[model samples]
Target chain A: MSPTREEIAKLASSPAHEARLLCRHNLVDTTSGLAGDYVQANLVILPSAYADDFRMLCARNPVPCPILGATPVGNPKRIIPDACISSDKDDFDIRTDFPCYHVFSTIESDGKKKVIIEKKTNLLNDWTDDHIGFLIGCSFSFEQALSQRGLRLCHQEDNKVVAMYQTKIPLLPAGIFHGSGFVVSMRTFQPEEVELVRDITRPYLAAHGEPVAWGWDGAQSIGVEDINKVNYGDAQTIREGEIPVFWGCGVTPQFAVEKALERDAIKGTVMSHQPGRMLVTDWKIVDFLKYTQEQLGLSR
Target chain B: MSPTREEIAKLASSPAHEARLLCRHNLVDTTSGLAGDYVQANLVILPSAYADDFRMLCARNPVPCPILGATPVGNPKRIIPDACISSDKDDFDIRTDFPCYHVFSTIESDGKKKVIIEKKTNLLNDWTDDHIGFLIGCSFSFEQALSQRGLRLCHQEDNKVVAMYQTKIPLLPAGIFHGSGFVVSMRTFQPEEVELVRDITRPYLAAHGEPVAWGWDGAQSIGVEDINKVNYGDAQTIREGEIPVFWGCGVTPQFAVEKALERDAIKGTVMSHQPGRMLVTDWKIVDFLKYTQEQLGLSR
Candidate 1:
């Protein structure tokens, strides 16, 4: 059964408790709207061999892959003070934090390597000593920030997943991770509200920050062929006087992995949390904004 | 002979003429005071074979090696409209534009690779089709902004080169670019005036933006020991009521190259403009600020 808003708000208030419930009992299938005050992260796990290249990919394409933190090789436990809940718990395991994980393996088939995706509840059995994990910033924190400012999100109102599309924007190639196009998530807003939405979300640099582009025809500029059909997630209808705003999506790294597998640049497995089943962290939204402000030299 | 402030101011008012004077005629060796309004760049030239790795290094270490523009492989000319001066003239060549160039070669000695620096007028005879040029943003633009805001720079007032030091802060490693320490340029200011200087210079992100550290203890935080000595340039005295402020220096890439050569990551030659001698580009200081503001989503 779907939890009520009050239940979600209670969970949001105590992220550590919520994480225990989700990780231990598998109480939630999707992390959306739960722990709204804290930062939720997208997960990407790979063998240590590809860690350097992946790091380069994240550094080069920061907008799409703003890394909150990364675990050292072979370390399943992440300990970032005030940034992650896992740091507080001794038994915190990345392999089972999320409700579901999508394990992708690069297999040689028909003279070419192909990536095959398999859904798993947890990676406890699949975890290896050579694996490294990366926790990337997600749009959830910024969405909560928007809601706090009274901005209406169409996806939440409609009870559907946010619309995601793969755009023609070429990501800056780094190392063996190249040639994959950029991906973006769309949120439609009234024409008059677009600027305000941008202003509110601009400070969350770790959470993909501000909208990359906005307008009725914004998707076309980034090479989105049709709004009705999305590469991932559900598509929302554009009402009268509504414009679609696009922000760099966390799903970008997954696409890059697929592209890398195709090019034989990556030969091992790549795993990630299922869409919307993010790793809820202990970090407050304000912390990220403060860090971004300081890094940009906006704060004294 | 060092040009006087009046002569440099006259040249600063006309960058195209100044560039011609510097390129065609044997003019001033240091480009510090010339072209105050325009952006000055530090030049790094390398073979196309190392272009990808070098680009990755710059992207990974943006504050230390903020790239303004890069020429295509084998292209001696850089034509970035309104971003660089080389675009304005057909004869503008990266090989001869600067007053002096430091050509570095990686040579094997005692079974270890060592980098040797040689000063030259131009790479006209050494220029090859396989070489690529990178024009990096220098702190000159932000220094001008600080001056415009009535901030007094100790190095400028004393007519000494900006004091530079190699900090223990290790740069984020990219492919073939690891273990190199970060480098910073220092300027001393009165304790009360430091905040104003940071506020004025923070907008120029293309140039090294803001002071990374300040005060006598600032250097130690980033891993530099002893303020009395420096790695490069002239040392300035920290006054009784003043504190030292350090910003990321352009010399970082050269240090990285040396490190890479030591590790045998780079087997080819690396060339750069001599310290204080820079490429005076056509881009205005305001343009860089606007670009930075836009990139950070600070503007509409």
Candidate 2:
């Protein structure tokens, strides 16, 4: 069954530590929706052979594909365990906690494994030791951050997906993976409130927060008319005399994965979140500082 | 004539604000080559009738149309002056600072107006009490910031112009003006340095900073492949393995202005930085708090 909003909101507002337990105890179906205060990451399950290229792509394009963590070859229990997930997939019983898992059978063709994973899947026994897991940052972190200011997400109001679009913008290609920049969902407000909203979200870009773009200044998508007509989610309402603002979204990884479809083998059984919910963890948003890599002694 | 790089860069890094003083004195054709430390801004000389809508557009899209400062109706100087040139566009001299001005007699029609005069001409005659001048942020700030980081701007390195592309991403239509997202020049980097580049740049998006987008991500009208085939500047050696990183560029306003061309309007001429260096101000990069009107307690 599809998830409900209240259930998702409840899960999102819950404490991160508790949220992890829900996923760990097999009480949730892919903590896609439960943690509102935290970041939701897209997961990619690949073989160790493809790991290096994927890692470089993340390094090359961190925004659309930030590396939250990844399991070591043959070990599913930890991926930057000190900072990322508390434990490995098996430890949390992820197979059940996630609403479902998509099982992929890599068919080798030519020198490369021809990736033919489609929308159809059942819990097959193909999951194995060769499987490597990767967690990518979600665009929802910005949405959750924005929600703290009492702004209403259109999806919350309409029970629809966030409006997303396919843009002419291309994603940085990594080994076997290429992504296209998609349409950013836009929210409109009265002309007077443009700066108000831009100001509210500036802190998240950097501790040195600055508004990237605003109004016509920041609204660098296709024109609003085309954007409104083409949407991945329901369009939001704009009061008379209001302008629209857009932000870089988290769905970027999805784009990244799609771009790689022809070349790379992608087997991601994305964990689902409760409606309005995401996985809230003990992770502090600021702790993911670029400067702290040395402190953490982690190699990129 | 357009400004040269060595001349522009020298003027920019110079301790003397003479380039501005020359423009202020109605001494130069345009201030394009005069200073480098500060940001160059586009001057929108609008009548009151078009002011509100234009303001809304700028506020909605801050990056493409950043509003650095604006004057009260009939006032030539704004409270916060454009940091690129001297604050005194009205009193100092607009006629000569720019190589030439594209006068739109009626901002609504994008109608052309006859050139009133040139450098050494009295702008006091054209600067009427009914006119309001608005200064919008230009790209020079980021360009200079990038050059300072040792990243060779392709245009300067290859002695070519920075390439621009029109994108499927469109701007929100505001009143009579319409525009699309920009296709900016790309810079290739070693895959690893992307984060460092983005971080050092965080403070400049607003007064503080903004996030950087990777060019290789599709649909943004830029990518590593496009780096070679269609660039504004002469393509440089990306070094066998550098990944190209892209940023939301100032050139966005150039496209916005171009699309708004179908109508007669209060348009700011494209003030392409002729190697236009910004007028570095007393503002230290660190003190940049990314303040908004609300944060400053000035907004109602």
The DockQ scores of all candidates, in the order shown, are 0.02, 0.03
Query: Where does model 1 exceed 4 Å of error?
Result: A3-300, B1-17, B80-83
**Candidate 2 positional error at A76, Å:** 26
| Tens digit of per-residue lDDT, candidate 2, span A125-221 | 4446776666666555555555676776555555555555554434444445644553354555566765556655433331112222346544543
Clashing pairs in 1: B85-B282
Candidate lDDT scores, in order, read 0.73, 0.47
Worst 10 residues of 1 chain B by lDDT: B79-88
Q: Which tens-of-lDDT digit does each residue in B1-300 have in candidate 2?
A: 544544544554333344544443334542322345555555556556656556645544554455666556775444344443333333333433433343433233245533221222334456666666666554444556667777755555555444444444344344445545544445566667765666555435442133335535532333334556642334556666666655444445445545555443544332222212222232333333344322322211
* TM-scores (chain A) of the candidates: 0.90, 0.65
Tens-digit lDDT track for model 1 on A109-223? 8999888888998888777888888888888778887887887788888887788888755554455676576688899888898768876776676787667667856667677
DockQ, candidate 2, vs. native dimer: 0.03
